[model samples]
Target: MKFASTGLTALLLASVAVPASAETLRWARAGDALTLDPHAQNEGPTHTLNHQIYEPLVLRDEEGTLVPALATDWHVSEDNPNVWVFELREGVTFHDGAEFTADDVVFSLNRAMTEDSDMKELLSSVKEVRAADTYRVEIETEGPNPIMPANLTNMFIMDQEWAEANDAVEVQDYEGGEDTYAASNANGTGAYRLVSREADVRTVLEQNEEYWGADQFPMDVTRIEYTPIQNPATRVAALLSGEVDFIQDVPVQDLGRVSQAQGLEVETAPQNRTIFFGLNVGADDLQTDNIEGENPLANRQVREAMNLAINRDAIRQVVMRDQSIPAGVIAPPFVNGWTEELDQISTDVDRAKALMEEAGYGDGFSIQLDCPNDRYVNDEAICQAAVGMLAQIGITVNLDTKPKAQHFPLITGFTGDETDFYLVGWGVPTFDSAYIFDYLVHSRDEEYGSWNATGYSNPELDAKIEGLASETDLEARNQAIAEIWEVVQDETMYLPLHHQVLNWGMTDNIDVPVDPEDQPKFKRFALN
Candidate 1:
């Protein structure tokens, strides 16, 4: 059992000089990629760093538009409706001069389906990945999968031979703290090649001259020096001092100051993510609460009361500095199944107190809330604000803030079900409700719910979530989504906070639009 942690895991590094050449883009973010192993973790920052050095069959442009990458074209086979046939791009080679072929696609996709791969859940519907020809591959799904392309945007492919040679065939066991060669090294068909890495300290990348899209893209940024500055003030100072060219997240409070500074710009966009708190309502007894042999969160009345106690507008105004949209549902507007009615939420303190009394917890109960300090914008502050709000409904919250690297495993099940209450930010790369249901709302099992920290489980709900992947009719699929969401909302397993708004701060010379998913492809960067 994980207790409340007062300390944070720090990544200490010495001050280093940042090259400010027009061809070099100095980048800084609040957190670092967990690993260089592409399939190890399905995280935004990790994928952002990996995208610079790796290529996926399908990629999302800065505007979140699906574009061809390794696969020149893809479509469901006319004869086999359940199979997705992909025409591989020719004349492509890995960084080590290995030819890219269908064999690599078959090997990599199967590798990603391994137990250790966090990308496995995304491919749960996939039956088999086989090579039809030298440059052609086919992915046979359990049924007709309409959203196959949407899921491939971030499913990076790797060189099978390289993995075998480096003994990195297995995805790195990140949660178990197992390290492998791939954890720190990479070779891909992407526009840039990894030069050096120092975990959370700093990393360097140089443009790949032989990259297939070298001529197709701007390729203006020849080198990328990435640094993760956990402290917001230090990160902002880095940008102000000309030490960094761009920052993925600009603190909301410093947006005006940074945008007004000489030769700087701040671009804003609604992120395709939701910030929320998870409750372990399935457990019989409270893990880290004041009351023993009783889980206050298990009671529906208590959960409803907790939800009512939360003031989303206050968090949006105070914690987010009016940068976030108060959310009623976990799904953002960009998702397919989102509706304003389902996203409408209200707060009533008196109603919450009455609900608590109805649940037989008229006085109060104390529980620990696990949160990440550097992962989300004002993450700790949001938890801090909620701690005070929850107190009004007689729920005493002990907030424990730590670096994401340490905090994520608490809910990820890579370690254990170590947390009863936690904060998590969910980004829908597929922009579908099924993606959310499969990962967050479904019951924890081999095929789904890898991120659902709450112990809540229902066999009927699990069947509905599974049906989404194979549902062919658009009208029927959407209705099923609505029904699933209704169940999720009524349970109140998660307390929705607000939809995050992204702010990318950069120098005026950079010409890159804000990606709602927060993954910036440097190859798309055009430096003036």
Candidate 2:
């Protein structure tokens, strides 16, 4: 229950706020990372913080390009199409001074694929990782994965020796509340080293003088002071008052105020993420619903009614302040399966009511909606809008708002589909549709569907989703992706709200562009 209350969380974070100096950057965001164990959580804020302290085999730069970090180059082996060969970067060292080698790569990848690892879905195609030599490693997959490199951008490499020494080889069971050395401390071969950490309050980091990328990238930021301010006004005030130099999430309502302020500037871009509501379609009976013997969400008519009830245009204009792109599909336009036609949305209260009546729920039914207050841009506002909209279709929504730390776990199934309906945002780091299918659309087999709380499972669809890993034929793979999208849309699996728009508020003296994924690499920041 850390950071359980917004007012208290904001006060605690504000008390620890530090001033920015020429060699230091004070960064503020809406939420703090759930844990420091890099592979434990696949979340935006967590990955943003971890990216500074952990070195991935490959990383998406400020320009969103797949660039090398630990691995110098990687390609499929000529001997075996299912095998990928990676050449490790030489002369690299972790924060604790452990030498980077192929053994670390092999060990880290194996660890990330464990059951407790939230990042296992990205490596689901892999069969094994083997160290071929001092600086060479081989990853054998179940089939020929054409986009394996794309998936490794966030697969952080941990120092195997350091992990073993600290007894942190296993991924921290984040949802289970298991605290280990790795969760509170970190040792990685990245640009910054963890100086101090206080969950949901303050985290201090210092630049690694011995970082291998020192000469390669800008490496301008020498020290960092990151604070999570849950309140939107407080976050904006920190940037305005010069207590913080940069804020990753600039509230849409405050974008103009921040931009017009004396020394502040706002940079915006279309984020590669979509916000949506997930229904527990697989459940026979919903725990929160007032109705008995059956789950309204399980019925396609009810699901369709809920989907049709959402007025994306209204939410965009009012709740989002026109800072969103209305989406009819969960996959953003940046993803492979997205189509202009599929991104189109329509709303009809009469139609939705008719569908609800056809499903035999003519009067109404009440269900609880678990939403994150600090996760996305105006997340609670969007959920609040949904409440009134869904009521038109005879579904009374009792809204429950929590911090991202508590809210995300509910959708991730730590308690096994703990809530009937919830709000979640997804960004495709791979820019591939398979990433969505593997995690959000796949059956909740505990391995494939880490975020698929819907419980809707189709063996045939699952086979197609799994086949996407090794399918080398480009056209065939794309066709299969289209087919999968068609099924998802037809099933009315989710109520997709809209694609997010990112607005970063920072001091005018800071030089950094808005990252499409909203994950800014501080090493790229330059002081004007």
Candidate 3:
């Protein structure tokens, strides 16, 4: 009888403690992850997961300012603007019990500069990443770069010894999956640890009890399950049905339904991302056969014509369901030092037609347009809408929509000396206009390296981008950006659509902070 009474008491304690202390937040979304290797891909669902798995040297605050993360404090060299010194927080240890040190930072950064790595170009400006001491490191840049912290925000630090032990040294080839050592396995000095991964189905993460940080409210959230439910309707249904706690990429159409749900609430925040279309400016030949020229997009007039034909307002209303704000330039509002002068693009169809006629295409021609089906919110639908709009100007668009997995390689692969006209969205990690100039405006041969997929090249723009990168004076950098924006608009190398809103539906039990930059962090969330 005494043993039975003791067992009953133990069961009562388990009932109260299990639900209170060991809560598992089941989050759902409508996209599959490309890879878990943080350096392999720069965008999409992986970004959200990576946020939970890894902590970079720096993180952007709510106001888009760079704040320390892994590093406790840092200082820019007074003598040389290119040199940045950082003081590492001592006593921080990786999940595998490996100590965090300067060597890990150097290994992760140097590996990021490998040729085969997709994110190699992000760290291309760094001349050297050397350890000044065990608790400090200094990054010497190839030139005077102001946006160093912003650029390196996504360069998550890895365990050098752990990586070497697992034979994960060549970070370029690490694709986290069934056949890889890094797949469903991780060893980071972050707040969580990867417990299990079921591809396209679910990923489970457990709180790192050994995390050397301030106490987390859900100190032991044993199993946070992340599931990718592709259909928007199904995802929303699951949320309303109490199957999931949170659902991302909430369809704009169902915002009303979600908002009206009994225990659910809807949240909308401006994401520092720009959705745009790239014309094949650098390609030797146009993908379409109707244009009989050497390179149709190469003609400044032709590029402008394509831009004006698409009614961005209609796309914002219909395709995006009014969830997007029309964009004038590549850089969005939240990006630091972004000016109003940069938002200068004419939406005149008649002028565009005149330009097209001058370029010898009075009647528009047929072309194949490439789009990613799973990359953005309603990405494929947006492309379909664009096809109809382009058709109005006699431009017959053969839309070739593919999943991001298949789409990224074919178009972004510059090896074939080709890239078809395609649609893409860039969420600027650095939250700076310099990111725009460096990635899109600067030439592939330059110090920062290549993100110029369209092959849009101009000597004037290159000089302006270079000037902005190195310019210490705030006004001087802004002036350089203004000049670069003017040249880009004049050339019409890209068609800017709108900065789409990120809609999320969640229970009011948690406080999820919103930053226009969309860092995907819930640094202060807790269950009521």
Q: List all candidate RMSDs to the true structure.
A: 3.1, 1.9, 7.5
Q: Of the candidates numbered 1 and 3, which has the greater TM-score value?
A: 1
Instruction: Find the 10 residues in a row with the least total lDDT in model 2.
Output: 1-10
Taking all chains together, each candidate's TM-score versus the true structure is 0.96, 0.97, 0.90
Q: What does the lDDT read for residue 257 in candidate 3?
A: 92
Cα lDDT of all candidates, in order?
Answer: 0.89, 0.89, 0.73
Off by over 4 Å in 3: 1-22, 78-81, 173-180, 214-222, 344-346, 416-418, 445-449
| Least accurate 10 contiguous residues by lDDT in model 3 | 1-10
Please provide, for model 2 over 1-528, each residue's C-alpha lDDT reduced to its tens digit, 9 standing for 90 to 100. Answer: 344343554554467545556889998898999999989999988899999999788877766788887888999999999999999999999998889999998899999999989999999988889999999999999989999989998888898989999999999998787999999899998899999999897899999999988887788899999988878987787787777898989999998999999878999999999999998888888899999888888889999999989999999999999999999999998888789988889999999999989999989799999999999999999999999999888889999998888887787753444989999999999999999999999987756989888888999999999999999999999999999999999998788999999999988888887889988999988888
Model 3 clashes, total count:
0
Q: How many pairs of residues collide in each model? A: 0, 0, 0
Highest-TM-score candidate: 2
Per-residue lDDT for 386-481 in model 1, tens only?
A: 999999988899999999999988888722349999999999999899999888988887778889889889999999989999999999999999
**Model 3, span 267-384: residue lDDT tens:** 8889888899977787677755366547777788887777888788888888888999887777788777566676555566777778878998777788888888766889889899
